[model samples]
Target: MAEQVKLFGVWGSPFVRRVEIALKMKGVEYEFIEEDLTNKSPLLLKYNPVHKKIPVLLHNGKPICESVVIIEYIDETWKGTPILPADPYDRAMARFWAKFIDEKCLPALWKACWSKDEEQEKAMEEACELLKTLEAQLKGNKFFGGDNIGLVDIVANFIGFWVEVLLEATGSTDLLTDEKFPMLCKWKHAYVNCPVIKENLPPKEKLLAFFRARQQPTSGPKYE
Candidate 1:
């Protein structure tokens, strides 16, 4: 009998999408179990006791937590489509940018989302610098790993989706404007339009609505 593969995730999470993309890339068949973060299940808690996060991949009852770690596991376990380069130097380069985005860019982007006006402006500036660095990095390559989609591409592409959504939700358009960061803008077009990515993306209208709702302040009954 074959080992059972299962994934616990939430639809709106980019981290969950990372695992989804990797599984799709590998042509791995797995059962996707959606979890409500507001009401997490015992299984999710058991699988990821430390972080208590979504996107736990269970293969033959062994759990793998964390999005990037899960992607690396998916790449190693499957032999059909290669997500990482076999060459040592290229693999190192891939890991370098993946680490860079996870460490530097993602946090800045999140800060920009939940910050106040002035703080948001500063966060946006930092995000632009990060995007500029990536724009320059991609000057001669189709993907971050060069010529083909790979690990860095999967991780880096998360920002592309959220950046646009953040720009729309926050009413700012400076991140990937043509005049400012042309390469990053072009990369967004290419990355999102790729067949695998395009098919797997969450709907834009729904995402915008979700963000908008999140931005609204909760109200209580007024007592005179």
Candidate 2:
């Protein structure tokens, strides 16, 4: 008998989308359960009691939490298109960038979007520097994983899709313009236009609406 695979996540979440795209890349059949982040489901709580977060992958009744961890688990469990490179050094590099994006790049971008006054300016600077670092990593490759979309590519989904919307909404495209971050911009274009990613992406208008609604004048930035 085959293992039962299930994913609990929100519809427009980049983290969840990464796992979804990986599943599609590997041709893994799984059940998807969308969770209301504000009113998280009992199953989400049950599976990820510590975080009570979505993007939890359940395989054969065992749960894996955290988007990056879940992606690695999916790659290891399914023997289809490989996510991580086989060489140990390359694999380690992939993990490093994935963590860097989640910890450094994402928070920096969030700050650029939500922080006010001097904080926002500082965040924009930090985000630009971080983006430059990421751009250098591409080394003119079609994707972060060289010729193919791999772990780092999935992890950096936000840059490919969400960043443009956020930048446009905030009137901050100057921070990541085609001329400023040419390689990064080119990579993003490639990443999003790839058939697998382009086809499964959430409707742009819906995603724009989701972020626009979140831009409340009073609320602090919340990294979901």
Candidate 3:
């Protein structure tokens, strides 16, 4: 029997995009179910009962929650282009950096984009410092995944694309100026311009409109 695969996600969510990219990279065929986060679908709730979050991959009736875990599942289950490295140590390092991007970089970056005044300043500094740490990781690599996109690159979708969008929508910060982090800026330009990645990304206008509607009063990111 052919594999049954379904991906449940929210539009414009970088986390969801991560899984989508992985699936496409592996040449896996799957159905995409767009979830309404405000009023989530019962299937989404059922599939991900714990966090009730998105980017859940349903494979052969089994649900995989969390983007990173789902991605690892995709890598192991499919036998096409590799997402994680082949060497055990390299794979472990990739997982480490993916964890850092999620647990450290994302929260600070999201907070920096949304928070204001002193709070924004603090968040921005923390985010920049974290980004600088990530920057150092890219000394010789064109991507965190070396020459091609991989786990860390996928995990960092938010920083590479959404940071600029958030900054534009808020019109409140210049946190990621090219001069401040030239290497990252260059990486961002290159990563998003790749044909495969560029085609899969949510339309910038739609994203900007969505985020513009979502601008908050300094309470900060919904989860971060």
Candidate 4:
């Protein structure tokens, strides 16, 4: 019997988006259960007992938690288009950059937009430095893994799509200007315009509103 596949995820989460992109790329058919992180469903809790997070993949009644792990599992299970490179060293490099994006790049970018006044300035500086390091990694190709979208490309959606929306909603256009980070800017344009990625992305207007509400004074605590 074919294993039943299912995913639990929210609309605006980049982590969830990465899993969706991987599934789409591999042509995997799965049921999507939209999660409200504030009031998380019992199924989500039951599957991902450790993190209690979305983006959990259930295959044949067994659960796999975490976005990156899910992506790898989908790639290994489906066996269509490969997201990770076959060469060992290149594969290691991909994992390295993907980890860097998750660990170094994203936190800095969040602090850049979420912090206030002097802290925001400091965060922007830190983000700029971190982003430039990523830009350096993109010196030769249209993506982190050359022409094709891959693991690093999927995980770095924050820099490609979310950061622009964040800057607009936060009224910080100067944060990611073309001149300051030309390579990254060009890469962002390519990443956002890529047909598969563009199709899967949440609408810009909706994303703008979501971020705007979160930034407001009395918008309440963030769940995701």
Candidate 5:
């Protein structure tokens, strides 16, 4: 019998979506357990003691933490369709871009979304520079790993989705405007229109309402 697979995740989390995309790409069948970050489940804590974060993959009761790590594990375990390149150098390059987007671009975008006034401006500048760097990196490649949608493409695609949400919430479109980063704007179109992504993405208006609700100030700490 095939080993049972389970994924603990939250719908809104990009990291969780990364794992979900990888699983779908690999043609792996698994159970998805929706996690509430505000009130973390005991099962999630038991499975991922360290970070207690979502996107934890469980195979035959063993837990694997982190979205990227889970993606790699999914790729290695299943052979239906390879998400990483066969060549070592190409694989390394894919990992490099994935790491770059995770470490630098994601945080910069978050800062830009949450910061106020001058800080928001500075964050937006940093985000624009990061997008320029990514646009240059994709000069001749259709996806991050060239013609094929690979690991890096899966990881980076979230930027397009979430950044749009942040732009709406923060009332800024400077980072993804056509004038500054045309290539990235085009890439966003491709990423969103991709069949799997188009099907899985959260509804825009609902997401907007969700973010707006989170942005509102709470009255006080209360017992209900």
Candidate 6:
């Protein structure tokens, strides 16, 4: 019997897009179920009750939650293109960078864009610091995984795409300009232009409008 695959995700979520990119890289077919996060569907809750989040991957009735975990699952379960590095140490490093992007860089960037006063200033500094670290890690490589995209590249999609959109929507201070982080900016262009990611990424104007709506005082900047 064929495997059944379904993805529960929202339109404007970087986390969800990363999973979709990974699936495309692996040539895996799936049903994309767009979710209204404010009013999540019962299936989403049933599959990911712990967080009640979108980007849940239901594969053959077994549900996997969290974007990074789901992408790892996609890599392990499918045999097409490799997502994670082959060497154990490289794989570990990729996973490490992925975690860093989520735990450190993304939070810092988000706060930098949405917060105000001292908090925003501090966040901007931290975000720049973290991005510089990533720039050095790039070490003049074409991509995080060398020539082709890999786990770290995929997981760092937020840095490549969402941060710019959020900053533009908020009309906030820009930290990702070419002058600040040239190598990273180049990497961003390359990563997003890759056929798989380009096809899967949401339209930038639409995403910007969605983010602009989120900035309303009533709605706040947090993604549901």
Say which candidate scores most in TM-score: 3
Estimate the TM-score for candidate 5.
0.92
- Give the Cα-based TM-score of candidate 2 against the true structure: 0.94
User: Which residue pairs show backbone clashes in model 1?
Assistant: none
Report the C-alpha lDDT of model 2 over 154-195, residue by residue, as the tens digit.
999988888878766666535778888999989888889999
lDDT of each: 0.80, 0.86, 0.87, 0.84, 0.79, 0.87
lDDT for predicted candidate 5 compared with the true structure: 0.79
Q: Write the per-residue lDDT of candidate 1 for residues 57-161, one digit (tens) a residue.
A: 999999999888999999999988789999988888888888999888877776666566787789789987887787777867777767777898899866768
On residues 1-224, what C-alpha lDDT tens digit does candidate 3 reach at each position?
Answer: 99999999877889999999999999999999988877889999899999998889999999999999999999999999899999999999999999999889988887888887998889889999999999989886788888998899888889888888989998767877789988888888889988778878999999999889974845433421
Candidate closer to the true structure by lDDT (higher is better), 1 or 6: 6
Candidate 6 lDDT over 1-224, as tens digits, reads 99999999988888899899999888888999999877889999999999998789999999999899998989998998899988999999999999998888877788888887787788799889999998888989989999989989988888888888888988888889999999999999999898888998889999988878764343232442
- Steric collisions counted per model: 0, 0, 0, 0, 0, 0
Can you give the TM-score per candidate against the true fold?
0.91, 0.94, 0.95, 0.94, 0.92, 0.94
In model 3, how large is the Cα lDDT of residue 102? Answer: 89
lDDT of 2 at 102: 89
Q: In model 4, what are the clashing residue pairs, if there are any? A: none
1-224: candidate 4 lDDT, tens digit per residue: 87799989988888888998998899888899999887899999999888898789999999999888888888888888899998999989988999999889887887787778887789899999998889999877898889888999998998888888888888863777888988888888898888889888988999899988873433212423
What shift in Å separates residue 4 of candidate 6 from its native position after superposition? 0.7
Rank order (by lDDT, best first): 3, 6, 2, 4, 1, 5
